[model samples]
Target: MIKTIAAWIGSYADHPDPRSALAGKIALVVASNQPFYPLYLHWIVGTAAWPAWLSLLSTPFFLAVPALARRHSFAGRALLPLAGVGNTVFCVKLFGAASGVELFLLPCALLGTVLFRPDERLKSAIVAALPFIAYLFVDAHLGEPVMMTSDYARLVALNGMSVAALIALIGLLCSTQLATREVEIVTTEIPGARQHVDISD
Candidate 1:
């Protein structure tokens, strides 16, 4: 069953409608951002209903730890629900009106990369591309009506960039692992006679 799923994901490289794979990622980012925007608005306008301390402590642990653990399956699969719980706590506590959309991208991408086989390059490419697309739309929407302070906006952008970079890095590392695994598999399977194939030939 696992092998079958891996084979299907691997087949994505040959699929025609490449964009469909990225659709879910794009939707998640856009939808999450909508609610997050209003929260930022409240924070900027000084009408933020929630206290800063309530968010400051919990949000980081909830978002960061799972994100870190998500690079490996054993811990990551177990911790994802915990991460979701943290996200829920944050959403309820910080309830003003901002899209916490940015928060989910890294986690989703990390989860996709870790849970799926590394040979599914198409899926990995889609996962990597979605965050970049989401950022462009989010950046464009961050003007005028949703008036955030320049410093705050910069901070948010920087954080998003950092998370995106981290996701890409994780993807690259996973790809390397997959390549190494493939090479090991091939080397081990090579017949003794064929193994003597010379480079000069």
Candidate 2:
């Protein structure tokens, strides 16, 4: 089954197929949200409303899929989610950890693993680490960790689910374009624009 899907996804090369790119981005969004599912459960049982910030980290990944599907900016698909991860790390300090804060590292690592090529992986590792590293510095400066207390069941469930999701994500990513080919991104101009003319002539 794995081999079949792997062949279907295609061999990696200097560039990604548009379909494979779309699948990769969608997979990212799916993998990114695994942490949030349990967090949402915590909110539902613990609060009257879902906190908007809980959705913060994965939103860009979700939003970027259409553009990626359309074969838009490679940087947008590849880099924007890193910003979201960084934002989430900072958010953990400002908010509380019960939103499955630590679990984000799983997705961040998984994201880097799939989105980056062999040559790019080192830089991708650094970029992926920067936010958490920055947060550590900020956290040390600020003081100790902030804990958000949740029910024992919720905590256990969140942790368990996070681990399972991480494993599944790793498995899924093994079939992605990164595993099959090198990538070369093509930049395309927007469909419409004003062209200059010598109207005075």
Candidate 3:
């Protein structure tokens, strides 16, 4: 079932370039994760937290990443980080700094790094910097909690662990891509070396 779901998600990332494909997959995965925030909010504060459920408004924009990419790859790539920053900012406003929702900016920054090709230095820098800038702005200027919750400790831990898990998942994807590239490079550099070493036998 997990494999099936992964394959389904990967279908949207059907670009020839491995990096672009990776970016597409990342965009879809991150976007798909957003709707769950309302569920988490409901769990933490019960079902009556209607105002907090407003975070779900960002899901469509996130889901639009792939559709926009199909029209223009740059648009899709650009939207991922932008949508992320927007979503995170809205979340920070809804829950405030104490909820640790701002920690999500870390992954948003990381997304910017991996989403763009190496040639797009300016775009990458802008996308990556947006998250850091938002974090600073939020930390400094955020006034009060829009949605009050007594469970500060739980919210902090939840957001922290959630961010950590996302980072780990992204790290695994990056490491896997790197390893695959390395293997391809080695295989290309070697001439008939595999034929001489029949490890399969």
lDDT of 3 by residue, 50-150 (tens): 56778878878777776777787877777877888888898887888888888888988988888778788775687879998898765558677688878
Question: Candidate 1 or 3, higher lDDT?
Answer: 3
Clashes of each: 10, 8, 0
Model 3: lDDT of residue 112: 84
Off by over 4 Å in 1: 1-76, 81-103, 109-113, 116-150, 192-201
Clash tally for model 1: 10
Q: What is the lDDT of candidate 3?
A: 0.78
**How many angstroms is residue 138 displaced in model 3 relative to the true structure, after the best TM-score fit?**
4.7
Residues 1-201 of candidate 1 have per-residue lDDT tens digits of: 999965653443221222222222222333334345446545554644234334444333333332343343333332333443344334333431133335545555455445434455564565445545554444344343222233455435534664575456545645765675676576678865335544324
Q: Rank the candidates by TM-score, best first.
A: 3, 2, 1
Off by over 4 Å in 3: 1-6, 193-201
Order by lDDT, highest first? 3, 2, 1
Estimate candidate 3's RMSD in Å.
Answer: 2.9
Flag regions of model 2 displaced more than 4 Å: 1-23, 27-39, 42-45, 48-61, 65-74, 80-84, 122-125, 131-135, 139-153, 176-201
Pairs of colliding residues, candidate 3: none
| TM-score leader | 3
* Candidate 3 lDDT score at position 155: 82
